[model samples]
Target: MKNIKIVSLTACLAWMLSLMLFSSCSNDDANAENSGGGPVIESVMPSGYNVDGSMKPLTPVTLVDPKNYYVIHGKGLLTTQKVYFNDFDTYFRPTFVTDTDIIILVDENTPFADASNQLKVVTANGTAIFDLTVAPPVPTFSGFNLINAVEGDEVTIKGKYFLDPVVTLAKTATEPEVPITIVSSSLEQIVVKIPANANHRNLAVTNISGTAVSKEAIGTALYDDKLYGMQWGGPWSGKGVNFDFDGDSYQGEKSWQWVFGGWDGGNWGFDVDMTPYKAMRIAVKGTKNGQVNFSVNGGSNYVIPVTTTWVYIEIPLSALGNPASVTMLTFQESNNDGGNTVLFDDIGFVLK
Candidate 1:
């Protein structure tokens, strides 16, 4: 497959300027170009530069990037009134329309899921449709399972835009990247086998659109199924803490559940050097919607909004008073809805 081109803003402007020049031709020619009864799409190609810094030709395309320009080569397009990709009514300039071509940019807001995968061109007389695919955006690295995984263990990554992803352990100063074996994959998830010679490294995933590197590297979990470095379960006033809640596992084999009442909280004791980490990340959902006061070292409280469905959140260390060490962690029922259960998983710090 050919490399996906990167369209520069300057080149895009140059093309638009050329379109203005095309529109400056005689009115007789414009009248003759717009005389056709129906538009007929011959092909579509990218309007961007090749990977080698050369201009891309008018070769037919199978996939078009969002927010990128492309040339629609067709007949009777001088009277082109509207353009749509995957049923999205994308805008196009009349000056960009000609007898056999319409240069347009794919809208960034076009819906990419569960819709018609075809480009439609409507002219004054009739309409035309062609099979096409709008490429997904870059991968979003949420979190991964088995946070303390070692070589040859299986790890599941949770995120979106994993289309045809290439998974690899990011390269370190001492060694090159180690490619992980894919056990299975989907648009939102990937299960992989940690390869031999693997270290505690971040995973990098790349699809056709772009690449994404995980925030939390392998083996950096404060809690996956259970809390790490747990000297104690809770502060004196906390209640109903479950170490292994099997009802749902957002990241690993289980999830941490807290049943708390008004003014109650769960506290755990640990001694972790927070210098190497940047942010605290977790996937949380509640029996019902609410908020919790999340903190470390009993410092400042960061209000975390919870929902019925799990929402992954990353709180920067600076927001939590930037403690140098973590001796105690706490989560208080701040938005008390009488009493409720909150589920937590993928609980860990983002390695620097």
Candidate 2:
């Protein structure tokens, strides 16, 4: 009798537990099916660790960051079929969904410009909309310069993610950022009026995500309109290369335009110490995509592939045999794609 009673008790406990689980699932399913009312979003909260690693409580944000997860707090979300950030169709997992909350990751490809600026949720019963802004990733501050720039000359900044950008120039490291006038802006380029106060300081571009600072500053170019401390180099006007006399430029009036034949090349002469610099930088584009062998002091060639669009690249000095002095800055056509014209500007070096 004792053994029989024990078995009965065990069975009874198992039945109770199963009944409770069924009831819980049933309640959730019922809530999800009760779609007579539409979904609503009360607030959106960021997920995960903070940048500072502080224990400060997380708060709701009006901005949705790309590549980050966020929680949607509201009712009627258990049966949510879709969520859109900035009208972008974002993917979410159903197992993570619930009636009052949803954990979803914002896709990195979500549009940050020219969008509805909305966070929408569609459920079985209805849909809900929340006002939210999608922020672009941190801006990339490749380089900026103005050829023969005076106090009010237009300076062109090159990089990525210039959406709703704010441009500032700091005369020194300790000084506050001074706002500059913007002439025009695109996703990867910006033209701003150079302030008189600009000096050997830093330039920064800020967007919703964060700021990107320049690796160098104004009045620091190796070749801006003219070379600084440059001895002599290049096609030398009818010798091997020429300027864009027609006025197509990467920044200012014109850039170095080279139309090469097969195996054509040119060299720039410089008698200056390069120990203070970290890399060789330039903004270049080609009429036809091709490659060139760039060398310093006739070191091992650093092959640079050029595209049709203007692109700024910084090649570390170490890549070119780490020459301590600038003797020969050479460019030789190696594309073998017949020959093509390439435009160059913002020729310079970056500080260590």
| Candidate 1 runs further than 4 Å off | 1-17, 20-63, 74-96, 105-134, 171-176, 197-199, 234-239, 246-254, 271-275, 282-327, 334-340
How does candidate 1 fare on TM-score?
0.65
Candidate 2 lDDT over residue span 38-100, tens digit each: 888878876543445432133688987777667777677878998999888999878667676
Q: Which ten residues in a row are the worst by lDDT in model 1?
A: 19-28
Q: lDDT score, residue 242, model 2?
A: 67
Checking candidate 1 for backbone clashes, the offending pairs are none
Q: Residue pairs in steric clash, candidate 2? A: 233-268, 235-241
| Overall lDDT per candidate, in order of appearance | 0.81, 0.75
lDDT of 2: 0.75
Off by over 4 Å in 2: 1-36, 49-58, 145-148, 170-174, 224-238, 245-345
Model 1, CA-based lDDT: 0.81
Residue 17 accuracy (lDDT) in model 2: 52
